[model samples]
Target: MTTHPAETVHDALREEPCEDAWWMPGPDGFAACALSSSARTVAEARRFTRATLEGWRLCSSVAEDAALVVSELVSNALRYGAGGGGKEPAAVCPAWLALTRQDGTVLCAVSDAGTTAPVVKVPDHLAESGRGLHIVDQLSDAWGWTPPDRSGKTVWATVSSVRV
Candidate 1:
């Protein structure tokens, strides 16, 4: 998902998605799935991400990075998204994870039924949490969220690597 010089990351994030067909592994190069606010969601997403990247023969290092991004994105979706009220989400909150590769870049995007904008936090050294976005920012070529539409929002990150 190379961006033009004049177009910003936000612009890319806002691009219209074919909601029904986005996950199809057709000519556009993608894999996607539905997610819930379950505690196991992050782990499941990680495994899915790794398998998809491996199937596509992405560089191992890049696959690792993309997996991390997937972890953080899904973790955030489970923890704070879908109006979790700052605690474990008790109700089913729908979410989705999509991976796409083109040229040398692999893009990871997760959509959740939450409207909050993500923030990179300055966690205390001994803190047990709150570093998700920081890790995503460090690993990704670029990262940001799409403005929430009627349903919710999508947060995306990109990592570029050579094909294996």
Candidate 2:
């Protein structure tokens, strides 16, 4: 985790990531963390996303939605991605959570070794699963997944800086 100077929540939310108000090739407004496929992953991803957004001066504006979306994405990855069936070794199931700010949008992406594409399922009210993508769809401006390559596939969602 990167530590930045403390600023007022309002000021931070209104501020952009870089000095010239543009994203460079580096960590101008990007943060990422590895996640384990355990019960604590959802909470860890939420904390990491919220903190990174706060450091980027976007917490007050989109933190709630971003955190929720991050949890959903990470949960799906843990449950369905490679090594998710509780049999594979952790080394074979590497996963990561990434955050980036670009052109007034915050992008949250989760990458995992699993090759299965994510799908949105319609479940009954009492069903315990299959609603992750639904919540992500409702909260994000846009969401999609990339096909798995040698490294793995990534599922991403975008949230506008300005609230809807």
Candidate 3:
């Protein structure tokens, strides 16, 4: 894929999955996966996320942050995405995650078929819900989402290896 220098942030995030199909063109490395929207698939995605970060020799801090991002993204996909006949409506939605190391940052992107953008809610102290995107925003250098060309959208984040 030809990466345009002036591409929008949405384009950049969408392109990462396709660009990272095998590996990225960088010194670090890349990992990509097309996951089924199922409970078992979520577990698999977690493993894949860990392996991908470790394979790239990312710092522990980056890896940990990436893991959390992966978990939240995958969980959101399984919950809101179309797959798994587990109490949810049946729709064919493919979920994916891609990781790439660029310059001094590690970029992670997760794509799913839900067009509704994710929101970071202010959860009450006693409530045991929400806070996924909130944590991602606080931990990563940057985080955002993109609507794909056809359907679905991708949520992405970047974190620096070194503490800022």
Candidate 4:
């Protein structure tokens, strides 16, 4: 279920973990879910994202970009997020993925238990590393990360949902 922005302002002030329904409406024009920490999670997230976008009637417009965004975000979370602890570098950390619509804008957010903000680095054209956020910046209308609270931070991007 969705609440008007003004009506939810007070609730928004209280720091809360990113729940499946965060900033979304009920049964229409919104969806969210948690992603398990696993190497395969990125691929699974991409598939889930495409299906969800299709169910929301947005696949024809933003499915490709959304899939790429989901993949990169989840991969980053698993690679550098808290669960790895810089020891078990291959471990995947629990993360959350959410989608919401507001005034013709579709927001895609990935939450992980990492306090570090994502960095956008300029990668050499031939380089294979450090280009995820750059790709996100190129594809989404806008992108940024929320400061971590008790649960962690959420990196989000917004894309226009209006099909041209």
Candidate 5:
């Protein structure tokens, strides 16, 4: 079995909005719950990702990669999807992150109010920010976007299960 840092996991769970975020029995013999949240800033995005990954008992390397992907996705939402003016906003739309486990894969999904789909651009050294999805494309086993039934779109990526 994979041994994780218990104290860190507990602390992160305490901060989640829902007690149970993602839960499913692992094919290998274990269960995991992944909780996610969203932020208007890159810093908050990183914090939320770190907390969720730690809570899920992801290894250091996987956690780091997941964090980076979350940062990019959240940043894109704040920039294009949500009406974040970068200053004090009169109102903010609900943005969220969700984790789910199915078929021995851990899926990380981010939802936002924007209808625009993410496009993977060819890597450009001079461009400032279009490379986010490109990186996600390379790291995740599979990634895509979907429109929610009510509103908004969800972009999701999958990671192979670590359970043993």
Candidate 6:
């Protein structure tokens, strides 16, 4: 974990074996943690999102929504944001989950080592999978994916809970 002032959240992760998990309270209202592109990271990411939001004194609704978004984003990253053309090994494919607060909103983003974009699929009750992005769409006020950089792409969602 690193809290370097100028470094972006993606810099906090490296494509190496995730021997241990770590978290960082980054500069300017940002916090991030390192994760591996594995199924287990979904639970871990949701937990981290809740903890970070609590630490930031955010509302429960925002925390809940953010946690769900974090789970979907991390799951997508692990499932789709992996493999092919220099993508790191699955066991150690580095991923990062980040949160940043701006007034009444919290931004949840997951960055991974794959360049593919996230697509929202039509809901099919019969299918066991392919509903992650739809959940993200329903929960987040706004969500989208960033184009791939040298390392990979980032999918982000925002949840706003401004009380009167």
- Candidate closest to the true structure, highest TM-score: 6
Flag regions of model 1 displaced more than 4 Å: 1-28, 84-93, 162-164
Decreasing TM-score order of the candidates: 6, 2, 1, 4, 3, 5
lDDT of each: 0.72, 0.72, 0.64, 0.67, 0.57, 0.75
Q: Which 10 residues in a row give candidate 2 its minimum summed lDDT?
A: 17-26
Q: For model 3, how does the per-residue alpha-carbon lDDT over 10-88 read when each residue is reduced to its tens digit?
A: 2333423332122222224766665664555655555566666666677777877778877787777656653433323
lDDT digits (tens) for residues 13-84 of candidate 4: 234332222233224766665566645567666766676666666645587788888788888876666463
lDDT of 6: 0.75
Better of 3 and 4 by TM-score: 4
Report the backbone clash tally of model 3.
0
Error of 2 at 35 (Å): 0.8
In model 4, how many backbone clashes occur? 1
TM-score list, all predictions? 0.75, 0.75, 0.71, 0.72, 0.63, 0.80
On residues 79-105, what C-alpha lDDT tens digit does candidate 1 reach at each position? 666563433432443677889899668
Which model, 5 or 6, shows the larger lDDT? Answer: 6
Candidate 3 or 4, higher lDDT? 4
Best candidate, lDDT: 6
Per-residue lDDT tens digits for candidate 2, residues 1-164, read: 22336542322433332221111122478776666555555876786677777667765658889999999998888777846334454354357788899756899998887777898898667988888899999889999999876556899999987656
- Model 6: how far is 148 from its true place, Å? 2.6
Clashes per candidate (backbone, < 3 Å)? 0, 0, 0, 1, 0, 0
Which runs in model 3 stand beyond 4 Å of their true positions?
A: 1-28, 83-93, 148-150
